[model samples]
Target: MTISAAFSNALSGLTASGRASGVISDNIANALTPGYAKRSLELTSNATAGQGVRVLGVVRRTDPVLTDNRRSAEAMSLNADNLARFHADFGALIGPSDNPGSLTNRVAELEASLITAASNPSAPSRLDATVNAASDLAQSIRSAGTGLRDLRTRADRTIGQQIDNLNGTLQDIEALNARIRRVQLSGADTASLLDQRQQLVDQVNTIIPVKIAARDHSGIALYSEGGAILLDGSAATLSFTTAASAEPHMTQANGLLSGLEINGMAIRTEGGASPIRGGTLAANFQIRDELAVEAQQNLDALARDLIDRFADPAVDPTLAAADPGLFTDAGAAFLPADEVGLSNRLELNAAVDPSQGGNSWRLRDGLNAAGPGAQGDAALLKAMSAALTDPRALASGNLGTGVMTAGGAATAMLSITSQASAETEQRASFAAATFTEFQRIEQEIGVDTDAELQSLMQIEQAYAANARVLEVVGTLMDTLLRI
Candidate 1:
């Protein structure tokens, strides 16, 4: 090779080695940084007459298939976790059978108090105890029902927040795509831009799982798993109006609540037909519309049974046909049409509730006993106790026909809630395990300091070799000049 060519080749080699060292340094530095991809400097042999190496830009190394899998698993894990949390929260509201303050336990307490009161009908303390137990049972069911409404409200607000975040993320991705395209057009490295875009896409995936499609100039398009276009040339607008508080009678179907809209079109956000059904957004909708509604229904059913069982004229006949029994719906008879919010309005009969200026001896007599005439008559109290344990087929709430008494209905409700909670938790565990495995694999293939150090060592050797070549070339040129 000519002296000039050898010198040129050596300088180019040194430049390529320096760039490679910089890339290795970057890899080692960002090893633990979230969303930072390992980078490698692209090189080409410029061996025409020994010119040396060409630096083509830096490339970000990532496994697209593995990243896609991990993202899907992450969405699934979050969905399962949200559902499990909803069911568990509802179960806690109703109280477990083992929990002393649970709905089932309250029912049993009221039943026992009635029997104890029946044994000593004239004792004021025993009568007071029965009334107090009745009050507690009603309050427990009411609190649970109210809690379900609150869960729905909170979930609705969360859905709004998630939708906002999703929209913002898509817009950011769109802007990043533009920046990346410009960089690519300018023949510059877009590795950092690509990394930023990936992080934004990850955020979007968690909110509403989406699939990425390759676009020209290192840009990308996003679409939902169910084929809804999220970002093409522009981002789609997602909208949801949150309610101040969810009510028993309020529902999207009834036009009292809002459903999700994409680009101003109503979209199904529940059941198997939902376009966005595998992320945190969907989970919040399920909590707001499905789980909480079903739980409220079941609680209302229990309350209905308790109210109807005692409302029977045969159970407390000292009054007229319209007189409510020990339990009432907001101090009145429970109409069949009003069962939707019965649990929320469930209350002790004001006539027997001492807190409401009622007499305790009324328990030994009747709800409308005309000022408690019978001081020693345990018949009514025993009858009320029987009314509590009487077998009756429940008409609603999907508690099945397996439950007989009011206590049995409450037990069935709690059991169903607890079982649902457990099943959802199990699914969450499986999803989390899958997500963990995928994440671990992705991390394992991520930046390795040891490997980067080895690469640095190789780059150092190349730099040294290139410097030696330059030294020899310079020495030969000097000798030639001297000759």
Candidate 2:
């Protein structure tokens, strides 16, 4: 071969080797960078009759199927995590049934106090203890009701934040799509832009669980699994109005709470059938609209049962049909139609509350007794004690007829809540496990510093070998000139 051709071939080899080394260095540098794919250099023999070699530019390597799987798993994990957090907060509010301060325990205390008062009905201290216990019970229910409403409020605010993030991400993706198309048309490598775009899409996936559709000019369109189009030609806008606070009577059904809107279109914001399902966004809405609302209903029903039991004239002879019970709703009679916020409004009857200008002796007598008939009468106190053990089918709560007394109703409510929390936590664990497996598989395909370092060694050898060939070519040309 001519010295010129030899020199040319050696130069091409050196150029390709240099490019390969650069790729290896880049891979090693970004070994742990999230969303960064490993870059590979392509070298090919020249097509010309006596040409050497050519560099075919760098290619980014990623397992598309594996990436999609990882994204889906991550979305499920996030959804489960949000739901689990809500349950944890709610469970903490009521506490375990075995806890001393739990709702069930509070009811048990009230029942015990009633029995103690009955043992010596005329004793002011015993009657006072019973009154205090009942008051404590009402306050406990009110605290729980307030806590649930607060959770709902926080959930509503979180929804707004997530939707805001979603909108911003979609807009950024749209901008990136345009940039990627421009770079592609100019025959430039769009790999880096593609990585950024993928990261943004991953963010959206965690909120709405989307799948990508390849568009023209290296652009992409995103669609949720629920058949909602998040981005086609442009980013879709997500809108939500956060409330100042949440209340039992405030609900999405009654238009008091806001639902999500997508690009001026009202979409279902809850459940598996929602347009944005299986993600953190859906979980927050479920907490605000479904879970918290249901909890309030059950609590109100429990409070209503307590009030109705003491409202029975047979139990309290002085109480008329129109009067409030020993346990009053907002210190007034509880109307069936106004039971929505009964738990929050439940209070001890002011007529028997000494702090409210009444006497504890009212417990031994009747709430409406014009005057104290008998100071030593234990009959009313015994009847009041028996009221707690009376078995009656509940009126409002979905708790089946099996629960007989007030304490049983409280136990049943706590049991239902705890069971739901356990189930959700289990789901969260499984989803997290699945996500971790997919992440491990994806990481296996990501940049491997060990492999990259090995490749660097090979590139060094090729570069040295190419340099030696060029040296030999120069020495041969000098010898030929000397001849």
Candidate 3:
């Protein structure tokens, strides 16, 4: 080649090397960023007409499929977390406690008091002891209900705060979208803007899984799997509102103006429907609605059942009044009016009070051995014991008849709660394990300082070679001039 051509070729090589150095610098700088896939500069020779090289663009090596899969796994993990927490709280009520004041211990104390009352059926102090035992049981149920309600309140507050943060972050994302679009239109370097955008996207993914796509004017669009448009360039935005204390659900929607819609339904700032599906939002919502509410409801049901069952007096075979029921009044429903079937289906118990006056020996089938036999108070106590033993008597929402026979209703409630608690703990353990694995994998794919340092070494050698070429060319030119 001619001297001029040779010099031109070397100059192109220098430019290519400079671009490569820039890529290496970028890689080294972001070596610690999580989920940051490695980036490489694409180079192509411009050998058609003249000799030169072109920087095609910066490309990131990432597995989109893996990214999507990880997001899904994260959603499941969060759900499991909520379930686990629910079970833990419920477990506290049912599971044995180290404290002497635990609910199970209190129930056992109540049972002991009952046995004492049976032994001294005519003593006022023994009857009072039974009453005291029932009172203690009520107190235990109340305490459990209180804890559950408190948890619900805390969860609601957290959800509110998180939603506020989500809104703020979304607005920021919208602003960044504007900036990215502007840079793209101007043909300026938008890599940094893109990096910022990805950061926001990643943050949002932890809160809720989303689908991202390119939008008009070099902008991006974020969508829910359910077709909810969360963000789109500068054209759209999503919003949500927490409910008033009385309302059962919160509202949510999408779009900047003309109101927003969640799942195609319009929502307002007033109480709206829930907007959660597989993310932190879903997890928090489950804690607030399912776990917390159910625990409160169950405890409340037990309280009311106790009160109603003990309100009446039991009569003898001769229809003479004998043993009185344990409670005088039942508590109100814990659920809201909108909760369908919550009132009738969620009642405590009707057969609890044995006092229709005896001969009242109207033996209820499960209680009376001879079927309406005249054993009177004796039969009633036996029935109570039988009722307690049947596990199916405990009312769980609308599920089954409450396990309220006298045999072991309290223990049954405790057992169910214990199982739920164990389930929650197990789920939490699994989520923690998966999260650790995710971190490990992320580290593998993300920045590694040693590896980046090695890359820098290669870049340094290339830069030196380019500089040497320039130096050699300069020396050769000087020699020619001297001739």
Candidate 4:
């Protein structure tokens, strides 16, 4: 080759090597960075002019299929994680059936107290103990109901926060899309912009399951899996209304609960038909509207069963036909329509509850009797004990339509709690396993520092070779001119 031509080739080679080294350094530096894609310098051989190399641009190494799979896996993992946490929290509130302070254990204590009171109907201390046990049982149900409502309220608040975050992310993605298009049109490096966009997309995926579509001018459009447009040329708006507090009677069917809205359209927040399933937001809604609500209903049913058991006319004939029984709905007969909040409103009958200034001797007499009956009359106490152990149908649909004793009803409620706890543990284990697998796959596709270092070594050799060629060319030119 001519000296001039040799000089031109050496210069091109040196420039290409320098660019490659820079790209390699970037890869090594971002090896541990989340969402960072490894980059490589694209080069082409210039055969026409015999130039050593021509830099095309930087290419970001990524597997579109793997990335899509990871996004989907992450969404599912988050959904499971939220659900598991809800179940665990609920279980902690109710405690295990065998625990001394559990609902069933409290019921058992009351039943045992009633038997002891029946054996010594004239003993004021025994009667007082029975009343205390009954009060304790009522308070346990009320506390559990309150705890469940609080969980629902918190879930509602979290849903609102997630909606706000989702809206913000969508807006950011829309702005990034415009910038990316402008950079592409100007023929400038869009790698940084693309990275930012990917990070935003990942955030969006954690909130809700979405489908991404390529748009013109290097832009992307986001849509819900159910076909709601989240973003196109502009970001779509999302909104939610949060309730100050949740109550057992407040439900979606009654329009007392909040639901999600997207771009002025209402959307289902739960079930298979829900538009935002397979994400953390969906899990929160399901906990609030479905799981927590169901638990509250079960507790209310247990309370209703307890009230009804003592309220039976046969158990307390001394009470007027319309008088409140041993256990009443806030000092009155429980109306079937009021079963929704029975747990929260359950209270011991004032006639037997000393805290309500009633006589303890009333346990042996009729609740409505003007004064204490025979001191040794054990008829009412025996009947009350039998009433507690009597087999009867429970009001809870969750426990199925089966006849069971008071203790059996408590056992059924505990069974429900145990089942939920077990399911939560299983789901958590599965989610952890899924997340670990996805992380492994992601790591496989991430930057390899060792590979980048080896590439840098190769680039250094090429740069040194090119520099030597230039040095030799310079010496030849000097020699020629000197001659």
> Arrange candidates by TM-score, highest first: which order?
1, 2, 4, 3
The full ranking of all candidates by lDDT, starting with the best, is 1, 2, 4, 3
lDDT of 4 at 82: 86
List the lowest-lDDT window of 10 residues for candidate 1.
45-54
Identify the superior model by lDDT, candidate 1 or candidate 4. 1
lDDT, candidate 1, 1-483, per-residue tens: 888988988999999999999999988988988789999998898866446888877889999999999999999999999999999999889998889889989989999999998887888999999999999999998999888888888898999889889989999999999998998898888898888898999998987889999999888999989778899989999988888888988999998889988899989999776899899998998888888888888888889888888888788887667777788899888888888989999999888877898988888877787676767789888888998998889978889876588888888888898899999999999999999999999999999898889989998998999999999999998999999
Q: TM-score per candidate, in order?
A: 0.97, 0.96, 0.73, 0.95
Name the candidate that leads on TM-score: 1
* Model 4 TM-score, all chains together: 0.95
> Candidate 2, residues 298-375: lDDT per residue as tens digits?
899999999998988889999999899899988889899999989999999998888889889988889999887687
Task: Write candidate 3's Cα lDDT for 109-152 as tens digits.
Answer: 65665565545444545545544555555556655655665566
Q: Number of the top candidate by lDDT?
A: 1
lDDT of 1: 0.89
Show the colliding residue pairs in model 1: none
In every candidate, how many clashes are there? 0, 0, 35, 0
The candidate with the higher TM-score, 3 or 4, is 4
The parts of candidate 1 lying over 4 Å away from their true place are 47-49
lDDT tens readout by residue for model 4, 1-483: 888888888899999998899888888887887778889899899777766779999998888777877887888888888888787777766667667878888889988998898888889999999889988888888888888888888988999899999999999999999999999999998987888888899999988978889999879999877677899999999978888888888987788987788898998888877889888899999998899888888888888888877777788887666667877787788888888878888888888888889977887897877888788888998998888889888866577677888888878877877787788778767877887787788778778888888889998998999899999999999999999
For model 4 the local lDDT of residue 196 reads 85
Q: Rate the local accuracy (lDDT) of all candidates.
A: 0.89, 0.88, 0.56, 0.85
List of clashing residue pairs for candidate 2? none
